[model samples]
Target: MLKVYNTLSKKLEEFKPLEDNLVKIYVCGPTVYDYTHIGHARTYISFDVIVRYLKYKGYNVKYVVNITDIDDKIIRRARELGISPQELARKFEKEFFEDMEALGLLKADYYPRVTDHIEDIIKVVEKLIEKGYAYVVNGNVYYDVTKFPDYGKLSGQTLDQIKAGARIEPDLNKKHPADFALWKKAKEGEPYWNSPWGPGRPGWHIECTVMSMKYLGEQIDIHGGGTDLIFPHHENEIAQSEAYSGKKPFVKYWLHTGYLMIKGEKMSKSLGNIIPVKDFLSKYEPDVLRLLVLSAHYRSPINFTWEKAEQAKSSLERIKRTIERLRRIMTYEKLHIENLSLDEKEVYERVCELRRKFEEAMDEDFNTPKALAEIFEFISYINRKINENKVPGPLARYVHDVLMELLNVFGLLQKFEITGVSAEVKPFIELLVKIRDKARKRKDWETADYIRDELRKLGVILEDTPKGTIWRLSK
Candidate 1:
């Protein structure tokens, strides 16, 4: 049975979806006010791997990631750029998708934006008002924290503790300091929609509660975001969602990814060290980033550095070479009944052993760092077989297929054209790419261009980034 760490319960629990063989997941998405940094990439990539593994285990998954297209950040940035909030949001939203694709992330089933669901949001606020869970002041609506007796269940704090530690904010005419907004009355020069309260927009926490209900239903199997969101964001979400629906548990599992630290400090705008996703891609392969993230447990904070990225790049190259070596060994027909002799029995058993280890690691709270070590162990076994010349055609083919399936579960090796390649051509392609790199480094423009044009004629595409030149078979 698979098990996962539940942030809400603060324990490792066997994963049993609300409905048999189906999982409903909701993750908080970007605000879309600026470019996505690597810190954001870590959260998305962590959840992407979890979703992929759930599907691999024969569960039908419906994942929803919300896009906060309307917010104070969006409004402020839009005004600074002399553009409307809608235009600014749409621009960054497009960029967010592009970065996700470049990182090889599987797209969520629904990317519902807050701007498109205005009617649904207003209706929820109206329902909360009618239910006595919310009150209005000066056309602004706020949820009555006192009404929800279990207000701080998710964050594990009492109302008194929250009120004492909460940030100082402008007096919003709320009943208590812990009370949060559900609807905000419109201010001058900001966008507004018609509502029963007045012309205004949905509050930050209300949009998620509204969208998740409309798309994924009242309660979900999993709800995830960064660890920083646990306090006010997720705590408030749980309180308001359950209160509105009269549901005992708003989410069965509350998951949070740990922070991505830079130089041992948390990434922030004031730090001036936020590295954009696009900038990281320009320096290393997408798989390098994925492997680096998976090298640590999802709930553990990861320190980002250029040296670590270089190590990942080198590690990925070694894996690619191992794959090529397997393919090269398969070119000559060698597997026969006699070839699967007594000596090969242990080899076959080792394959089965590694599969079990991989699954066991993943089952234990999606333990990717342990899972990766299992993969590396299998690779080492294959390398030993290669040196011993005991790898037959049947064994080679089986190993190739299994490795591909395993790598893809982690969203690695998918971007590489690993299948349907002959042993003779791949080596020459690598050689030519290396030659072109040397030529460019020495400012040999003619040689580099000639090689690129020649490769293009043969359906090989070459892209030159600051790191180096990379080639792929043209689609």
Candidate 2:
């Protein structure tokens, strides 16, 4: 059975979906004010691995990530850009999907937008008001924290504590300092929808509660997001949901991934170090980014750096070379008739052990870095055996199959294509090397160094091996 570290219970608990063999999950999506950054990528990719593993283990998983198309941020940004709210949301939604697809994140089963479900949001708000859990003040409706005794259970913050930490512009109509808005009265020159209390828009928290309930029912199997969302966002979700449905638990499992930091600091716009996913991917391959993210445990913070990405790229290239060499050896007719050697048998056993270790690590709250290390260990063994020329045809094929299976589980190795040097570029490189060799023979050190420097700028790396000069693309 798979185990998950639930933030609510503060322990690793065995995963038990409300319905057997079927898992229903709801993930909070982007607010669509700007382009998604690397932090967003980390959270979504972590959840993608979880979903992929669940299907690999024979569970039918239904994943839903809501699109928050309406909010104060959206309105503020729209006003700044001098566009309609719908236009602003549409532009960013397209950009968000493009970035997600580029990173190989699977499309969620349902991507409900708040604008499309305004009727349902209104209905839920109306129910809360009728049940004495919500009150309207001066055309704005707010959820009364004083009415719900269980308000602090999810966030572990009492009303008194929230009051102490609260520092927003005071409004006279509010009953308490900690209460949050259910509906905000639309200001002049803003998008407004007709409601019982006048023209207004749904609050940020109510959109998710309504959309999740509309698609996945009142109670879900798992509710997941970043750890930063565990505050009033998720806490309010639980309150409004349970208050409306009279359900004991709104969610069975609460999973939160840790933050992504850069150089020992949180990545944020205020710090001026926020890197967009598109800009980052333009400089590095997607698989390299994936490996870098998975190198750290999902629950731990990932520190971002270009050097870390380079290491991941090198590791991935080594695995690619091993697979290619194994395929080439298996195609050799002379190797087909030979019996497997003792070393080949040892490699096969090591492969099995590595697979077991990978599963064990993942079964323990999705420890991806440990599982990734196990894969690297297996790759090292295969590389050593190939260098010694001790691998047989059948054994080589087995290793290739296992490598592909494990890599696919992490969405790596899906685009394993042998990159050949282009005919034109190959000839140019050969010509330059020949000239460089002539220059070296004549002891023209300046000319030789210039040639090497130019090629390096063109993404070509040259190495001096005993066999002669070897060149490859700079990963």
Candidate 3:
């Protein structure tokens, strides 16, 4: 069984979806006020792996990540850009999809935007108000925290604790300082929608509650986002959703990913240290970025730096070299001439052990770094056997199959397109290999060595066998 770290219980609980073999997940999506950064990439990529692994294990996953198009941040940004909020949200949503695609994140089952669900949001607000869980004052509607006995259960804060810690603002209409807004009155230059009380926009928390329930149902299997959103955001979502639905639990599992820090500081745009996903992906391959993010546990804070990225690139190249070398051995017909040996059995056992270790790590709260280490262990074993000339055909095929399966679970090795290498170069390398074979046959060591050195300079390596010479791309 897959075990997940549920933030609700603060424990690693075995994942049991509400429906058998089906997982309904709702991830709080980007606010769309600005470009997505590496911090955003880290969260989405981490969740993407979760979804991928669930599907890999034969669980049907319906992943829905909402787009918060109508919000205070979007309104403020639209005003700054001198454009309509819809136009602003549309532009940024396009950019967000492009970045996500580049990062190899699978498209979520539903991309429910808040603007499109205003009716549903209003319906929830109306229900809460009718049930005495919400009240309207001065054309603004707010959820009455006191009415909900379990208001702060998600955040582990009681009403008194929140009231004591909350910064008191000049809102005479609110019954208590701990109460949060469900709808904000429209200002002169702000975006507004028609509501029962007046023209206003849905509050941040209510939007998620309405949209998630509208799309996924009353209670979802998993609700996830950055750890920073646990307090006010997720806490409010739980309050409003359970109050409206009368459900004991609004979400079955709450998963939060840790933030990305740079040089011991949190990565934020206001700090001017934010790295956009597109900007980072331009210099490094998407798989390299995945490697870097997966190098750390999802629940642990990852420190971003150029050195870490470089190491990830190097690590990916090492895996690629092993893959290429294994491909060469798998396709060599003469290698099948000998009986599969005991070393081959050992290699198979090692591959199976690595697979088991990888699964164990992932099951332990998605410990991606430890799982990645296991993958590298398999790579090392395959390369050692290849170098030792003991890689039988069956063993080589087994390695390839196991590696692909593990990489698929992590969403790596999916982009196996031979990049930066021309198709014409392959024929040229093959011709050179044939010529080198002829020279070796004639005992022309000097000429063969010259050809080999030239090919090496051209980023090609030739392994000479008794039958012939095989060429592969050199790292």
Best by TM-score: 3
Cα displacement (angstroms), candidate 1, residue 438, comes to 29
lDDT of 3 by residue, 122-237 (tens): 89999999999999989899999889888777778777778778443537888988788999999998888998899999889999998889889999999999998998899989
Give the alpha carbon lDDT tens digit for every residue of 1-475 in model 1.
8998998889999999999998999999999999999999999999999999999999999999999999998999999999999999999999999999999999999999999999999888889899999999998999898998988888898888877884626464988888888999999999999898899999999999988998899989999999989878988888878878998688999999999999799887668889998999998889999999999999999999889999898878778867866765564454464558675766776777888899999999999999999988888887777666676767777777788888888999886756544678888988999999899889999999999999998877787745456565553
Clashes of 3: 0
User: What overall lDDT, based on C-alpha atoms, would model 1 receive against the true structure?
Assistant: 0.88
Tell me the deviation in Å of residue 89 in model 3: 0.9
Query: Candidate 2 — which residues are off by over 4 angstroms?
Result: 167-169, 331-341, 421-475
TM-score of each: 0.88, 0.87, 0.92
Prediction 2 TM-score vs. true: 0.87
Instruction: Give candidate 1 misplaced runs (Cα > 4 Å).
Output: 168-172, 331-339, 418-475
Between prediction 1 and prediction 3, which has the larger lDDT? 1
For each of the candidates, give the backbone clash count: 0, 0, 0
Could you give the candidate ranking by lDDT, starting with the highest?
1, 3, 2
lDDT value for candidate 2?
0.85
